[model samples]
Target: MNTRWMARSALAFVCCMAANAWADRPATQTERQAMGFDDPAQLVMVRDLPFPADSDTRAPDGAGLGDEWQTRIGTAFQGRTGAFNFGGQAPSIACTSGTERFATATFDLPAGAAIKYVDMFAYDNSSSEEMLVFLLSVCQGTGGADPPVSTILANSTTSGTPGDTVVTLNLSSAPVIVDRYTCRYMVRVNMASPGGTCVGGSIFLDKVRMQYTP
Candidate 1:
């Protein structure tokens, strides 16, 4: 074999191996820039709120307006979707008066981190079932403006037939800024319907997940 040909072949082999190694490994910032690729920022799952089976407010027990809704099993104002059962906004307090029917869950968010969005897994079994998710501050407001900020993360009005047609409500566009030292935010799920229409079929909240960016 010619020495020049052998040297050229060896150089090509070494280059091929180096290219394969680079492709196998995660892309570095410089490599991505060279390829004209901007690695997309991945959403980080910061919190997951699932319905507790042994929840006290599952059925007979009632979750009155402005009540702590940690347990979510047999609570008042609930409906079943064959696949899963969830709490609904029955005995709605929002229409009744200043009070509102909501289930509150607190989650720890790191200080200075901003909320990207929230995912609410639920199904609307009835027409015009209004589901509202809000992110509230945990402490008093520095300027005394409502003490805490109540930002609406997600809101959906169901308009489909009653069935197991579950869907995910994405509150991606609404990003709430987290700047509290406590690093805690309260999530409230307010499920209800039009005035004077508290029926059995309401929006059922099955699960909730949130993402944030530091």
Candidate 2:
């Protein structure tokens, strides 16, 4: 098999491991019960936002990466098979310079959904000098397109290990619930400091991985 396919297989296996956690658990009342049967089956809800190359806008460079989330365009990457059908440039975002820059994306998660894990796939071409930060947040989507962030649910940093390949990074945190309709899920990426020699556009945010249930 090709190297890309192998990488994808590994990623799929890793993702399944997360779903396995919710397996064997009692089915939710709204689930199989509504179907008129009591068969045991776990439900996995995943919402992916493929950071389209043209979707990011420059955030205020003066903030410390807090409630300064700006607006971005696009819906969840779900149902977009064309997104993965890559022949040329794949979708992604990168650090402009060594100074920290932020690219934000919106995630449309179902109501009453409990998030299990927030994961991100990162590509590090140079070294540790090009580490990136991935975070999950919730904010009130008021004031038009821009939303004011309220809480930072989870955050994680890339190891920059295996320097030339893509690795998975999990934002280690417990499950958090969001009930407010005005508030929405946010995925913000803080590009690495001194962004490194990966200047060939090597060091960048690849794709986001999410494991949760609705």
Q: For each candidate, what TM-score against the reference?
A: 0.42, 0.47
Judge candidate 2 against the unseen true structure and give its global Cα lDDT, from 0 to 1. 0.44
Worst 10 residues of 2 by lDDT: 79-88
Tens-place lDDT digits, model 1, residues 158-207: 44546443333333233345667633565555555433233344555565
Best by TM-score: 2
Q: Report residue 143 deviation for candidate 1 (angstroms).
A: 11
The digit string of per-residue lDDT tens for model 2 on 122-197 reads 6656554554433344455556565343344444455556444433332223344546476667665544444322
CA lDDT of each candidate? 0.42, 0.44
Summed backbone clashes in each candidate are 7, 1
Error of 1 at 16 (Å): 42
Best of the candidates, lDDT? 2
Give candidate 1 misplaced runs (Cα > 4 Å).
1-100, 138-154, 159-174, 182-184
Candidate 2 scores a C-alpha RMSD against the true structure in Å of 19.9
| Candidates' RMSD to native | 18.7, 19.9
